[model samples]
Target: MATMNRQHHLRGVLLASVACILWGISGVAASSLFMLNPHITALWLTQVRMISAGMILLVFGQFAGVKPFAIWRQRATALRVVSYGLLGLVPVQLCYFEAVKFGNAPIATIIQYLGPFIISIYFLLFKHVTPTRPEALGMIMAFFGTLLIVTHGHLNSLAISPVVLFWGGLSAIGVATNTLLPRPLLPKFGAVSVTGWGLLVAGICLNVFGPVWQDHVTLTGAELALILVIIILGTVIPFLMFAHALGYILPTTASLLDAFEPLAATVFSVAFLNVQLTNYDLFGGMLIILAVMALSLNGRKMINFLRSFRTE
Candidate 1:
């Protein structure tokens, strides 16, 4: 029993780590696509990615007996699913891709880390929940990290363009919506079902705006191969692997392992893309990642502290 448990634990860790690493590498891959081909717009890439991954997930869900389309049987659930796709999935991918296009993968991914702090703010404002000291401190750290990333300690000069900053901020909001908007539906519909539908719906909406077939960019064989990498290795595979790993490990453990994502992006950006990072970028990235780790590892303690604050 003990050996089996240990094996499961190890498997979970490996799966989570690999998934996150692949996700991080995918960001760099997207960056590469942009650098190699200026004609390839983020809008076009996002549409292709969402449609391709969305279709695959739905098909896989069918084979796995998930009854993927059953969520559409009810009008309310269907509406909610559509909302998730439009407001959650679409913006998250679109804004993040834009951020990566304007900025490097490392900065984009690190900035998206602000999503959790945004979630905390949502809870505080809407649910009237008070944050623990650690949670509050994490938010503060995230703020300074973002400040450094954009301003580099000097507010007068912008280290990155305003476009990147805008997209990064939107990406964080998208992340918050992506995380929170699907919660009520997940219990009844399952993550795969909700996400699959959400992606498909978002894909369709994006296509309506700019159809993938109409994308005028000509692609080389290598560029096409990288596109496949983004669709398969970066998006679908990691998503599935992370979901599966949850069966064997705690969610908190998986969340902590998510730290590898930004790390991988930073390494790959520097190594392959020849992107240079300043001290501000490095320090800001560290603080953001540390804030995520602190929040995840000390979630229960943070909750306890919140309760104590309420009592006081």
Candidate 2:
């Protein structure tokens, strides 16, 4: 039983890793979308992506004996799904793409990584949770690292635009809420179904305001194909994997592992987006990476250390 549990744990980690990896590379696709058409708003793109991917997940799950519309049958479940959709799905996806739109992929990716730090603070204050030394230090490092990146080690001029900063911060909050909102629903309907329903709700909300069918798409075939990648690989697949991960591990742990998204986004940003880095940027990035690695590996110890300070 122990070995089986270990195997499940390892598998969960792998799934979470894959999810984050896909999310990391998603910046590349989003970056390409902005380049595809300066006129294509993230709003419209997101609406389309959500609606399509939601449909796909709902349809596909039927083959696996999963009743996609089962949530709609229950008033409470339906309400939760709607809430998760409007609150969770929209913010995380929309703000991320908007950040990527305003800033380059690397900047958007790194800034959004503030999710874990935000989570830590929330737990410490609201949940009265304690982090070990490693996690506490890691959170501190991540905070300063993010500040360094944004301010470029100086407060005079931010490295990215103010708008990017706003969107990025919102994206981080969205990530936190995204991870938190689905906990109740996951145990009831499983990952894919909950995600599908949430996405569907988000899609309905988004499309309610945007003219989906009437809007003329100026995207070339190649751009549409890239958007498809954003819809399927980035949105659908990763959410499913991460949702599955919640069953096996804590959401905080999954969020910790999500540091890879920034790294992966950085690589693609440099290689494809031609985003150049400076020494300060590299230093700051290293700080964030090291902190994430530390916390993810042994967060409980750090949480405990943090608790000691509060006690003293």
Q: Which numbered prediction scores highest in lDDT against the true structure?
A: 1
For model 1, how does the per-residue alpha-carbon lDDT over 1-312 read when each residue is reduced to its tens digit?
Answer: 999999999999999999999999888999999999999999999988888899999999999999998898999889989999998987788999999999889999998878878878887897777878888888888889889999999999999999998998898899888976777777677888888889888988987778888888899998999999999999899999988898899877887898999999999999989999999999999999999887777677544544454343
Q: Residue 220 in candidate 2 has what lDDT? A: 88
Question: Each candidate's root-mean-square deviation in Å?
Answer: 3.6, 4.6
Indicate the residue-level lDDT of 162 in model 2: 90
Score each candidate by Cα lDDT. Answer: 0.87, 0.80
Q: After superposition, how far is residue 245 of candidate 1 from its true place, in Å?
A: 1.0
* Alpha carbon lDDT at 178, candidate 1: 91
Highest-scoring model, TM-score: 1
Residue pair clashes in candidate 2: 130-303, 131-302, 131-303, 131-304, 132-301, 132-302, 132-303, 132-304, 133-301, 133-302
